[model samples]
Target: MTPSQIAAFCLQLPGAREDLKWGSNRVFSVAGNKMFAILDFLDEGRGGLAFKVDSDLFLGYVDRPGISPAPYLARAHWIALQRPYPMGAEELRAALTRSHQLVVARLPKRLRLGLLLDPA
Candidate 1:
């Protein structure tokens, strides 16, 4: 999916917000602090997208075409899809939703409760 599409999908999740970092990369985070997805836009051309995954999913995805461990965050079970992503729009959106859930689950109980009550 395009970066704009990814951003749109990610924002559909509870408390999801987009932040720009390293100038061009769009970072999607929930519950105020934790990030679940990133869309990297390079000066030369379109860049890849990265998100967190479970260990089992990480292993399975890394072995697939166009998928790899995310730079600097692989040890935490994050994965990246190279530019010209192999997955379809729906698949990418599902992954982003799951990643957002995973991050939200790790958030403080009070904050998580607030998000659930009012996911603005």
Candidate 2:
């Protein structure tokens, strides 16, 4: 997805918010301070996208062309895509949604309830 599209989709998630961090990166977070995705504008050439993936699926994702373990976050199972083209747009959206769900699942019970997220 394009940067604008990504920003829009992320902001639409329950209780999601965006902050500009490190000057050129857009950080999308839920429950206030926990980040789920990042769009890096200053990345060399055409920018990049990074988000957390299920720990069990992390290696599989990074092995794909155009994707790699996200710098500094790989131990937590985050992955970076040089661009979002390796996957179809719908697939990318689903991944983003899963990333949001994963982050939400770890949030405090009160915070999750405040966001009106189901306990699934």
Candidate 3:
């Protein structure tokens, strides 16, 4: 997906918010400050995208063309897409949704319940 489409998708997730960080990078987070995805506008050519991935699948994802371990965050099982074309748009959306869920699952019980009850 294009950057704007990706941004819109991320923001539609329950309690998800976006912030511009490190100048041109757009950071998407849930439950106040736990980031689930990031879009780097400064990358040459098409922007770069990164998101959390299931730990067991991290290595497998990074082995794919155009996918790499996210800088400084890979140890936590995050993967960066140098270009969004490595996966189809629908697959990218599914991965983004999974990333959001994974981050939400790690949040405190009360916060998760609040998100479910009132996503505004």
Per-residue lDDT of 83-105 in model 1, one digit per residue for the tens? 78888888887888888878887
lDDT of each: 0.81, 0.87, 0.87
Model 3 quality (TM-score): 0.91
| Tens-digit lDDT string for candidate 2 (55-83) | 99998998899888989888989998876
Q: TM-score for all predictions? A: 0.89, 0.93, 0.91
Off by over 4 Å in 2: 41-45
At residue 88, give the lDDT of candidate 2. Answer: 84
Q: In angstroms, what RMSD does candidate 2 have relative to the true structure?
A: 1.6
| Comparison by lDDT, 1 against 3, better one | 3
- Pull out the clashing pairs in model 2: none
Best model number under TM-score? 2
Q: Candidate 1, after superposition: displacement of residue 1 in Å?
A: 2.0
Give the winner by lDDT: 1 or 2. Answer: 2
TM-score, prediction 1: 0.89
Q: Give the candidates in order of TM-score, highest first.
A: 2, 3, 1
- What does candidate 3's lDDT look like per residue over 5-113, in tens digits? 9999999988999998888889999888999999874474367999999999999999999898988899999998876459999999999999998888888889988
